[model samples]
Target: MRDAHYEWRCKAITPIWTGDAYQKNGRMIPSGLLGSVRWWFEVLVRGMGGPACDPTDPDSRCPDKHGNRCVVCELFGCTGWARRLQFKIVDSNGQPVQAAIVKDQEFVFHFTPLRPILDEEWALLDLTLRLIADYGAIGGRTVFKPSDERRRENMPQHKDYGLIEITSWPDIKVEERQLRSYLKQSHWRNMDHGDYAWASLDNFWCANGKHLARQNKDDSNFNRVLGRDERKTCKICGDIHDPPNKCPKNNRYPHRHSENLINKNRTNQWIAGDKQESKKVFSFRHPQRTFGFVNPEVIDFSEMKKRLRKAWPDLKDDEFHQGSDLLNDLIRSPGGAP
Candidate 1:
């Protein structure tokens, strides 16, 4: 495979990431652009049938360290493999970007290729780009998923869509030219160019559900529910849904005092919020464009309000709640009011 390079310009569609952990210079990007790229690469690999590993599962995310490395790790590099690529990021002014850490801020990145990639790796990298354009950020929050209830109603969840522009040497084959053309009018210049991006490199979007997790049984986000009491049965319906976190009733924060709304009125004995506290392990889901446990404290109060409205479309913008407050509303009341 011959060596070649490509360039990309992007804007943060959502607050890339939030929280003190990601605090830096004046912005936040998703665990650094490379980290986000790695995530997309993994997703592309799995989505293309490269491997069945879950992006959130470390054991599966990376290949066996000793001798068997997965296709993703081989190119993206992991403890088991050396990275097949290298990058150099900069602003439009041609100055290198700095990830100084800023809490709860939106960030973007403008990538100017610094090294030529082997021709074979181009396809995978192209696949990665498709994912970014189609999936936005990979781990904490995703771009194209509709809410469970919304989907059941036959609503197709459209991708929240991120802003991205790519320019490459014509001789080099690139993926999705139409997307790039729409992004920047197929602008091509013989000379080099540059731009700026602000993504919360240290934000928790990388860890919200899977990154924050320590285990996975090797399946979609649907089956990764956390288990606390394997033998416990739902008191209201006397049903046993394998993992205890499957209760549709328990909602929000620290996982304790998380109520089971199912038994709310029927038994007046709703899983005693705190009774199952010590014995319950909470299952976390992939947060769609909406933010969940990705460091809410560091997220801008105003932005939090905005994203909250989307998460709970039933609520008006003026009445949108933030943090756990919004979550509490998600658990329907005994009367069926959201």
Candidate 2:
């Protein structure tokens, strides 16, 4: 009876934290505190390489603009990892070109000798790999048949196939030493390479259902990629998402701009055109991209102590009414010191 009833058991539900303050068994904690902790862990992984990569090195997207570029960001930008890697090369004659199969996706392969490829050539390979991975098998599609003639008749024709035929592949561990070496060599290059940088830098992607477009709520124009105006676009009011300025209506900006969709159905007094408030009726949000802003020097403990000393004539660090732990925690968090 127990064995039979086990199949009828309901799967446990994991409650999502929405960052609301709540009491858990009498101890107060934010509703999403667990998620917030997970988010911080991910940011640490993305900004500074996790234990796999060097934790001491800064991986935050909000790097010292003048300082080193992040290593975690670089690895993330290197294209997401694929489960089954395969490669193939087809010539103009639709025959397999004899070359080493260095790397492979479902249908495509990077040649061993590093075939001279222009940007267009790489794009063609990229597009072809996308199609094959979505549809075809690694080496090539095979159709089993009773006869040789039947097999030839049914098998999909392709130039040729090279097979690495990996089995029991180990997961690539984060290489902290390699990551450090890579960062040291390429730190200068990382400074200005954010044009193609993806959401791994900022948690902007979390605001959406992990959709790139949905995450970028400040973008006024959807089609433009590298345009100077590219920023996060808010869905509700259709305005660029910025910071430091509240919406004209003075509503508390949603934690993630994506949450504003919930407010869409609610009648907005700002939108209803209350004539007396018409001047303030038009609402706008801040842009997601950091505008041209100078970096202020990081305030160290000694500097903080000096300022506090002047204010209190002698207020000790621990004697302050509020704990400095919260401020210190914010400083260490990935979004980078507030």
Candidate 3:
């Protein structure tokens, strides 16, 4: 069987962290980068109004009652199915990368098809990589929050990780209709209500030239936007304490509204040590950019913009790009525009 293979040369703009199971950084893990690619691919699928199952959730994963899979599952695979693409990272000399942290290095992403890959699938993958190179980030630790621990330390301004430039790519042309038709296939449809949020293009929002501010004494614009824990004070004694826990002086708790972007409910999930997973808003410090999808059920576009502007006064109206608008602008094919 003839296998479809493609390669792209990439340069890491910042440090790339593809850590091991122990969360130790300093080595290249192909699976780590593949996972990030899959994530962005899933986001793109959902943004384009295609079905993509949450692979992490057993109930929402692929191989449904009819043995059908979502568009993402068909290519990336899930339980009971193997991925169609084999991914690898090699240095400029075509040697396997030995470094843990991929910083300022030129590497190549080698993708070999394990099965007969379709043109639409290749187009989708190409689009995803291009998006990451242009406006988004890749790999892990892209959303590093310096305010958490290094706020008081005299450290240099934190640079964004996972930023890469695609220096070269194989010549492959696919029409927009091909992708649309492929997504419309019956086998790629799955109807499952999962807890994981689907990042649709209609709900996506992004901006450049604005980033989280570094720590300035106790003031950090970025931290303020992300939100800080405000301990509730005892109503009687005026002592601070976490909710549901009694204060030193009094048993009664104070009733106050939270001003955090990530509320109490989401903050509690961070106890599992995956703070990035719990956050909805993602920012890059060096590029001065932020991008995230909003749950329209929770907040509308105007309201979300208002809240962000409240924290970032320098942000202008012209700087923001709605997901739908970006799709139309970035995609070249006629049918690519939504």
- Name every residue pair that clashes in candidate 3: 26-100, 27-100, 210-288
**Which parts of model 1 are misplaced by more than 4 Å?**
18-25, 28-31, 52-66, 99-116, 138-338
Report the C-alpha displacement of residue 150, candidate 2, in angstroms: 36
In terms of lDDT, the best-performing candidate is: 3
Residue 80's C-alpha lDDT in candidate 2?
38
Model 2 error, position 140 (Å): 21
Q: Any runs in candidate 3 off by more than 4 Å, and if so which?
A: 146-159, 227-277, 333-338
lDDT of 1 by residue, 1-338 (tens): 54544555443433333213444224434345576677555444433334323335554444544355555555556664466665555555645655532222233343323344444355456545543532244323333322233232123232222323333212334333332232232221111111100011111121122211212222112112121221224544444343334555543212321123323431122111245221111122333222222222333445433433333345454343232332122122111112
RMSD of each: 18.4, 24.5, 6.0
Candidate 2 local lDDT, 1-338, one digit each (tens): 01110000011011111212342122212222222222232333333322212223344342344543233323222223211112323333434533322234211122321223222222222222222222111221111111112223223221122212221111122223443343355343334323122112121111101001112233322112111223334434555434554454435552334323223221222222133322101100111111000101222234333433432354444442211232233233332222
Candidate 3, poorest ten consecutive residues by summed lDDT: 266-275
Whichever of 2 and 3 has more lDDT, that candidate is: 3
Local distance difference test, each candidate: 0.35, 0.25, 0.69
Off by over 4 Å in 2: 1-108, 113-175, 190-198, 201-338
Ranking by lDDT: 3, 1, 2
Residue-level error in angstroms, candidate 1, position 234 = 23
lDDT digits (tens) for residues 40-92 of candidate 3: 88878887778888778777878887888898888898878899988889877
